[model samples]
Each structure stands twice: as C-alpha cells, then as structure tokens.
Target: MTDKQTSPAVSVTLESGPAGTGSIDDFELFYARRALDRFRARLGRQGLLDLLAADIEEGNAFLRECARTSDGEFNAGTTVLQARGMTSAEFLAWMDAAFAGEDERPLLAAHPEHYAMGTDHIGARVVENIGPHVCSFYMGGWGTAAMAWAEDADELLPESEYPRKMSSNLFLEDGTVVGRALIQFGDTAEGFTANLTVYFPTSCPKGVLDHHLRHYAVEFRNWIVAAAEARA
Candidate 1:
C-alpha cells in the first residue's frame, strides 16, 4: 500500500512601505516601498501558480526550490509602479503591444515570429524613459507560451494565490543585456493597480535601481499629465 502525502500550504507576506509623513523624502520612500511590495506579491503569486501547474518532473524541482523555511514560511519580494493618465485597459494594452512589437527584435535577437506567438515567454519587451535615467528595451522571457504553473480554468487554487499577468522587460541599452519587469493589476486609487517588478543585472549598481524607480514614478506622472494636456 502507498502512503498518502500532503504538501504544506504556501504562506506569503508583503513587506510594508515607508511611513507616510508629509515630507518629500517620505512620500518618495513610501511609493518606492509600495512599488517593491506590490511587485513582489504579484511575482510570488505567479510562482505559486506555476508550482501548482508544474508537471511531475518539473513539479518536484519547484517543490525542492520553493520549500518552506524552518520558520514555516516563504519569503517573496515585490515592487510597484504608479502611472496616472492611462486607464488600466490602456496601460495593459500598451504593455502587450510594446512587448510583442518589432522594437524588441534587436535586443531579443529574434523577431516575434521566432517564438510560438501568443505564449507568455514570447517576444516581450519594455521601452520607457522614466526621467533622466532612460531604460532601453530588453527581452522579457523567451520560449514556450505555456506557464510552468498554469492550471485549467476549472482547477481550484488556494485562496491566498492570485493569477498574475507578466510585462515585458527593460534593458539598459541597445545591447543584448537583460532586464525585466512584471505587473499584477489590483484595486488602487489611481484608476488601476500598477503592481510592477523591475529587475536589473548584478553588474549594475544598486543605486541605479533606486534612481530608476524614482524616475519611473515621475515618468508615470508625466505620461498622464501629458495625455491630459493632449486632450485639452
């Protein structure tokens, strides 16, 4: 007779942002922390989904890597990006286009046709200039469309998990070097949830990430303000 084994539940916690005091530095810190946590949560949730959807061979690997710590917990990091002016639909649409468009071919080293189009890991790209720190387009994920952790529509998932949508990646320059961004939509005061995760390579300075995040917040404000101006 075979003994039945049950896996432990996954626990997820999002870290808090900076304290909200009426100061410029405090405000900036608060948003930065917000972006980080939101992004992290979205990423973790997606990972959980992937783990649940893995094949036997792959599932075992994920279980080993995603094992609960001795503290009976799993720690996941996330971030947020706040862009005004655009509706959630508009923003999401823009993301889809930017990711699969021809602009990404140079960095990705292959056209959109190179992959089995419409999959999650296809020719995704991110192109934006938040502020003084301009981020070039970069390849997000490249390969099959099927997510390692996706389940059929009828499959049940844990209440703590959320289905996530991925965004294209951002590059530092026109080179093949890689950078990434992931997003999860949620309820927010600014029209839509802009849960975002932006990552840079280890070769880059940590300070660069801080600067880019700040600039990115400003960039979002600028984009919406500009859109409003265009309409006016």
Candidate 2:
C-alpha cells in the first residue's frame, strides 16, 4: 500500500454550494473524485457494470454462508457516526430518496465514483471507490422487526419508521468477498446515530481495517451534512 503521507495534496476552490469556501475536507474529496474519474475512464461504463454483475453473484453466496454459520475466520467491527438536529425518520426519508434515484446528488457528493442501482432491497447494486479499492456489491435492507432480507421494496417498512438497516457484501473485481457491512440507524435525543458494522476476514491487515474506519468517518460525515443541507 502506498503511504497516504507521500501523496501530494491538491487544493480546490468552490465557487458556489453549501460549502461556501473550500476546506481540507473539500480538497481531499476533490482529489479522490479526480482519481476515481480517471479509473472509471480507463474501465468504461459497460466494462465496470459487467464486473459488478459478476461480483454480485459470487459475493452474495459467500455473504449468505458467512451470515448463517457465524464464521469464526471473519472479524466483525463497528463504527458509529452521529449528527445533531436530524431525526432518524428524516435521515431514513433522505436515504429512501437517494436509493430510489429521486435525488442522489447528496449521496454522490459523499464519495468518489459512488453509484447505486435499483431500490433499497435485495439485488440492488452499489459500486463505490474508497481510497485505492473499488468495492462492488448487491444490497439488502430491512426494518429491525424483519427477520430476513426483503425480496423487494414493498416488503420494507415505511421510511419514517424505526430501526432501519441496510447491508451488503463487499467484493473485489474478481468476486472475492472482502467483507460485509451492516448499517443501522437509530434516533437519539439530540439527533440521529448510524452504526456501521463491517466483517472482514481475519487475514485482513489492521491498517486496511483502520483505513476503512477513517473512510467511513469522512464519507458519512459529508453525507449527513449534505442531506441536512438538502432538507434545509
């Protein structure tokens, strides 16, 4: 892995938006997006979609088995992000809009080359570039009361309800199941809290896992702020 310290920082100036003047956060996101755009250009749209489809098929089976057996070889970890002045209901509604493609700009603003296809149900695909990794996966989400993954969006609880959770099996291009992520949301006294639990194989390096924790912090913080701004 290349040392992040060795990478040159690129500064950016935003002429207009919720982010009035650019900050270090904006600069980092800008650099990451530029890198991801270069990557996408190399692969082309069709080529990337093809790879995502194959990975979905293979990764789903691997994730299902891991979930069933409580596999010991996988290490599970959680990272939580909290925001003030936003209710969980409001956040869920925003998520619904994002997943349905009704308004995905906030989501797109959260990360580099983030693409979500299909509704927030079984078989929905999400492709994201985090640092040097291009993660592709099929997603499923459910309410806390639900026992299993919903087959379609119709089976899910209304976005305004409680205990909403989304999950996916992360995969590499070759269909290797690198990890799984479960994102759960809850209402707090002041606002909302999102808990992201990830499972990675024991063989995965600590540095890699730590990097993901940092990645989640950056992207989710941006996403929450963007969503709030949109609502405002």
Candidate 3:
C-alpha cells in the first residue's frame, strides 16, 4: 500500500443524479496502487471461481432477500471477476469443472435459505477474457446474472468489443415493473472498479434500491478481501 500520510491510501466519491429521480449516477472509489497490484497477483494465483464462491457465501443472506422479495425473479447484473494466474482458456475450463454435474446446487448452498435446488449452470466463453484482464460469467437461477473479468488495467474500457455492460428490465411475475439495473467494469491506473447503477421507477420504493446497493458493495469488498487473504 502507498503511504497514507504523504498520499492517501484510499478515497471514495459519490455523485447522484438530479434530485427526485431515485437514481445513482456515479460512486467513484479508489484503492492504493501497491495494494491493488498485490490483490491482482493473488487473484490470478487463486482463480476467480474461488473468490466468487467466497463472495456468494458471504452475501447469501442479502441475496436470499433479493430473490424472495422478487418472488424468485431477479438478475445478477454485471459482475467483474479479476484474475492473473491462468490464461483465458484455463479459466473457462476451471469454471466448467467448478460448476459441472447434472445435480448442481447454487454456489451459496452453505446457506439453505439462499440455496435454490436445481441445476445451476453457467455458460462462459473460452477464446478470450470478457473485457481485458478478467473473465466473465453468466449465472442462471432465481433470475440471471452477467459478469466480466479484468486481469489488468487495460481490460477496463468505457466501451469494448466484448460485452462490458449488462442491462435488463426487472418485472414482477404479475407484470409489475420493478426497475432497471446496469453494471459495468473499469480500471484505474492502480486498481479495478465496478459500476453498479440501478434505476428504480418512481413507483418503486427507495429502501429496495438502497438494500441492493449496500449488498453489492459488501459482496464486492468481501471478494477482494478474501482473494487478497488467500493470495497471502
């Protein structure tokens, strides 16, 4: 990590859209350059599957609530999984083996409350990593999920040939409009960042959006910490 006294170790900035829109435009976060490099090194050696598994396990409770509230209808949005150890092909193979089998269960099976009994399979591309320095995964269960992986700073692009941002309209089973959620990934000179922007319709409650944001942040941080620790 960099010296906090001479240079700040970390910083967070929040910017919201025009009031009354019930939307978040930007939430910029920065991590120390050295620390980020260490995390990236660890991520590659440890692999994204392990980190993702840890993340889902840690956030099982919040995830359950989201699924239950949506009556089992939800979307995973865009999640970025960073790595370094293996090439894109190896990463995809590792992913297949990790979730392979006909009788697979949700990755959060440790928490019965969040476990959905059924075949939980994810389809991934092998030719290359989703963005630049990362591999992406799409998970299907309560609703669906899309994720990207970044192994280096170059992978995080505002726009890329591969799918960098994921968008979807969530709706209640009864046809009620829930809201729209957008997820994107990028990288700074020092670290990688994920942008999860959700826009709830005026009819939607703010509490719901708040919970989702909190949950996402918690899970992201948890994974990074877990990956860092494992690398150590």
Candidate 4:
C-alpha cells in the first residue's frame, strides 16, 4: 500500500474515441494500478454514518438497518448454517435490500415483539463481521436468508443461503462511507466501468450521487491502472 508515483509508461489512451482503438493490455495495466491507489488513499472526514442506540430494541433495529445497508460473504451453500463471514460487497447488497424494505417484518420480530418465536429460531440469523476492522459493529440476532439476484442469475446463492441480521437499530451518527472502484479489463469490456451504483431518490434533485460517484469513479479507474503497472 505504498503511494509511490507511477512511471510515465502507464497511461490511458484518451484519444481512442467511441470508434475505439486503444490497446486493451495498456488499459488493464492502468485499471489495476488505479484501483489499488484509490484503495490505499485516505478517505475524507465527512458524510459518514455511525450509530449507537440507547434502547436495546431500537439499537437492535438500527443494527438491522446497518445489516440491511452492509455487505456479507457466504460459504458454498445456499444456507447460513453452513456459511461463514461477510464480505464488503455482500454487506452492500444486504444494505440495499434493507433500504428496499425486503425483510422488515421478520427483522422487527425481536423479543418483546415475540418471545416464544424468538428463542425458537435465534441461532441462525447472524453476521460474523463485515469489514477488516473488528469493532465497527457487534452482533444482535441470527437467521438464514437465501440471496438471489437477476445479474448473477447463473451463480445461485452459496448453497442457496445468506446470513441474516442479528440485531436491530442502534445509535446512529454521521460517519464517512468509504469504498473503492476498480474496473477489470477483459477483451469484450474495453471502456471504463463502475461496480457500485450511487442511487438517487425522488425527494432530491437528480444526479447528486452521480456527481460524487463519477468523481470517485474516474479517480479510482486511473489509480487502479497506475497501481497495477507499478507492482509489475
């Protein structure tokens, strides 16, 4: 994760227009480097969200919301009982689902809400940890969920199982949302690509997320390409 400047040999063929004539090899080199650089670069100190709830239920609810908004990973089975830790990407997917109101009913079923039913199926819905850091979050509840997507339609959820949120709401506060961008180069995919989609809402004006996402996108793309070549 060194920030050494890249050599001049690495460059993006910007002139190669819509008609397309840039060397794919060079593009791959550029993409990989830029991805690594942005990854190591320091994150801004604003626009972040963190939470801590005083009430256990609310705190647990908030945790649920966090899981809903986070990414998780799975073992090669369609069940949480057999699966393992969460990944950054998986946490993101879970967050999107929570935001979409996919699992509110079951998530809200914490104790006081339902006691007999609670102890019956508690061991399953849990997330080990999402990020590299350990203390970013703590567990709340447990259950098994099967993740399905239209994009990776072919690759079914690991053993058809996805981990469930363990807790609900906690105390939430402002914290920066940090992520990286990397465009992998393949023969068919020549132009730049963004893996994460910054969504916009009906209440706000259009393109707010787009502006931010694109800004990071370009920086990440260039950084990935640059960093990959430097490592070589």
Candidate 5:
C-alpha cells in the first residue's frame, strides 16, 4: 500500500428543490438509512437468523482447529497498531461495547455503507464491500478461555491477569469457513499495542489478500481513533 491516503470519490448530482428543501448531504443521510433498512429486510427474508445460530457453532469449531494447527492451507497476516494515552483495558472495553451492539456508530462510521446486524457478544452477521468483492460473513469473537482453543493456553501475557484476546472467526451464510481474525492487545507504559491477525484460504488470490490487509489497516485505524475520541 502507498503511504499516501486517498478517500473514495462521491458522485452526487445536484438538483434544485422546493423552498426550504433539504441539502445534498441530507439526501445522502436518508439514502444511507434506506440502504441499511433494505439490507436488514433482505436478511430477514432469507431467514438468516435461524441459520446463523448453527453457523456460529460450526464456525467456532473451525476457527478452533485453525488456531490449534495453524494450518498451512490458509494464508495468514497481522497488522499492529499503537495507541498512545489509552490502556489495553480501555481499548478492549470499547471493543466489547461494539461487539455487544451497545453502540455501533464507531464501526459504521469507519466506512460508507458498512452493514452489521444481530447483536450478541458472541456473534454478529456483517456484509462489507471489501476490495473487488462484496463479502458476507458470520463473525464471532471471545476471550481465550471462552474459545477453549487449547493452543491459546500458553499464549497469555505474563503482565496481565485477564489478558484481553479476541479470537474472531468468519463464516459464509451456508456455513462455509472463509476466514479467521485474532485481535490481541498489550499495555505499554506509553499506552497500548493492538495486534490484528487475519487468516484466509490458501486459494485466495494474492491481490485480494493484499487488498484485505490494506482494508484492515484503514478500518482498524479509524476504529482506534474513534474509540480514543469517544473516551475524550
């Protein structure tokens, strides 16, 4: 990825409206809400919730195996971000809220039209337009003890009594395993370090994989900043 950052272009056509009418920004806001509503409706029509419960169960098991074996059939990568003036606990508290759906604004605000539904600490269904593909996945995350993925036993931080670790697994609608993400945080004297690791099938194209890495960089950075701002 280039060091220079560029925002996505918006193509809005200005049209004259009646007196006291809303501005283009207002229309964009309305459209965004409508889009989310449509997405929610589509998921409802597909009976996704009923299937999601089962998918989460299977997906968790798949992720456990992946964590244990560190399978060669999957390609893995990590992105580390440092945040000053924030403790690891603080960052994790904000993250817990996000996962529980107490407040998703920070996550939704990270990107345009990012869709998420089903608010549970253990799982959520999300649809995101990442790179060349519009991807859908069932995401579930929890601490190492909850994960019960034995390999994590030796990975705990010595400095932390209850070290924060979020192991997230991604699965398709049909219960097909697609990817896994592990988010770990460690406290530093200055602040904390956030480590994000993603795993994808070996069959994934290099271009697609690279784009996802960049996507993680963009979204996570936005999320961390948003979290810090919220605390302020």
Candidate 6:
C-alpha cells in the first residue's frame, strides 16, 4: 500500500470540539503527537487506550499543578501548554520525533491492557501538579467505588439518521466498559472539574439505573473526605 493509502484500520479520530485559536490548534497537535507516541512505544495496540488516556490525564494533571503554582486558573488539557511556554507547533513536533523508529505493528492490538479491572492501572497514576481544581473522579464497580457512570436509553425506531447520543461506558473490543470522562463545569471560577469515571458492568447492570446510581453517593462522599485529609 502506498504511504498515502494506509489502511483505515489504524486511523485516529480527533475527538472534535469547538475549534480554538491558532495556539489552541498547536495544543491539539501536541496532544495528538502524544497519542502517536503511545501508539508507537506501547507493545502494540493491546495497551493503546490506557496508554493514550494516561498520557492525556497526565497532561491535564500538569495543567492543574501549574494553576496552583502561579495562583492562576486553567483547565486540564491546555494547562500543559500554559506551563511549558512552548508554541503548539514546537510541542507537537517534539512529541512526534521523540517517538521515531521500531517495527510499527501491522495491526493495532485490540483489547488493550487485556481489559483493565475498572481503572486499576489509571488509579495508580501519580499525577504531578494535581490540585483541588482537577480530580479524576473514580466510579464503576460492585460497591462504593463509583463516583458516576451513565448509560444510553435505546429508542424503539432507530433508522440511524439522528446523532445517537454517545453516552454510557467507553468500551473495548470485548465489550467491557472502560470508563467515562467529563470536563465538569461547576460553580467555581476554575470552571469545572476534569473528571473520569471508571465503570464495571457488575455494579452498573441493566434495569435499575437509579438504584445503581445511588450506590455511588458514598463514593463521592468518600472522595470529599479524602480530599479533606489531604488538605489537612
């Protein structure tokens, strides 16, 4: 296949949102480059989501950290940009080259992390610059570990023209729900909380969505208590 004719199997889709200014475009490029690094350095696609998500999380965490240091306000994704003081293009190119070489996989591995048990790997992430402004909320499971997890309601007549709301747990090939992430905007001037809720099917089953959601009330409370201790 020609270089331009690369197969569709290995394509990457940027999670599109409102386009930003010139510098924001560069920021997107930099994050995209980080995604490329994970695609290359990881032991094939078996760990792609975790690797990529972790990279993204770490970058957000840095932004939170910088906010604390400067007594400033910033969100997770762009915080890395504000702290590093590099133009978007420079960061993007640096990340791209930092991951050159090796036998790139023929097909990206499916079922990354062999199916992580509800954020087991991500929970262990030591986020530098993590402040009160940014907290990756943990949820999804059989007990009191869920912060929040949502799902979609099926419609009776689905011919497929409507944009089906992308709700519910993010899944891998095996159909196991990984987690859901949201950039939460609250009453604070900081805007919102960068939250990620990991899901486990056993805890969040079909039919009693309300009852299942109630199980997480304690988890949020637990996070608050833990945060208090950390502050003390």
Number of the top TM-score candidate: 5
Candidate 3 lDDT for residue 14 = 40
Q: For candidate 3, lDDT tens digit of each residue in 73-175?
A: 3333333444333333333333345346343221222111122222323232111111111212233222343222122223244564233454444433223
Backbone clashes in model 6: 5
lDDT of 1 by residue, 1-232 (tens): 3224676697544356546446555566767756655554465533523443333234233222222221222111244655554565665555456445544322221211111112233233232332222232435442335222122222222323324455443322233434444445543456554554554454344554565565445544444454444346
* lDDT preference between candidates 2 and 4, better one: 2
- Give the alpha carbon lDDT tens digit for every residue of 1-232 in model 6: 3213444666554566758544555787677756755755653434544445665466344433433353321121101001122222332233234223232221111111111222243332211111211223322232223323322212211223222122233223222333342212122232222122222223222222232233233333333333333335
Per-model CA lDDT versus the true structure = 0.40, 0.61, 0.38, 0.28, 0.63, 0.30
Each prediction's Cα RMSD? Answer: 17.8, 7.9, 16.4, 17.8, 8.3, 21.6
Error of 5 at 119 (Å): 2.8
Candidate 1 wrong stretches, greater than 4 Å: 1-87, 94-136, 140-164, 170-177, 226-232
| Candidate number that wins on lDDT, 3 or 4 | 3
Q: Which stretches of candidate 2 lie over 4 Å from their true place?
A: 6-72, 102-105, 113-122, 141-164, 167-178
Backbone N/Cα/C clashes per model: 13, 0, 10, 67, 0, 5
Of candidates 6 and 5, the better by lDDT: 5
User: Which is the winner by lDDT between candidate 1 and candidate 5?
Assistant: 5
All candidates in order of TM-score, best leading = 5, 2, 1, 3, 4, 6
Poorly placed runs, candidate 5 (over 4 Å): 1-72, 117-122, 141-162
Quote each prediction's TM-score: 0.37, 0.59, 0.34, 0.23, 0.60, 0.22
| Candidate 3 wrongly placed segments (more than 4 Å) | 1-157, 160-163, 171-177, 227-232
lDDT of 4: 0.28
**Displacement of the residue 33 alpha carbon in candidate 3, Å:** 30
Ranking of models by lDDT: 5, 2, 1, 3, 6, 4
lDDT per residue for candidate 5 within 1-232, as digits (tens), equals 5435887696666666546678878777778867765665566524543545555455444444443454435676777787788887877787668867655556665665354444543358775543455555777635434345414533333446325666766766555557777667787789888777776766655655677777777777777787798889
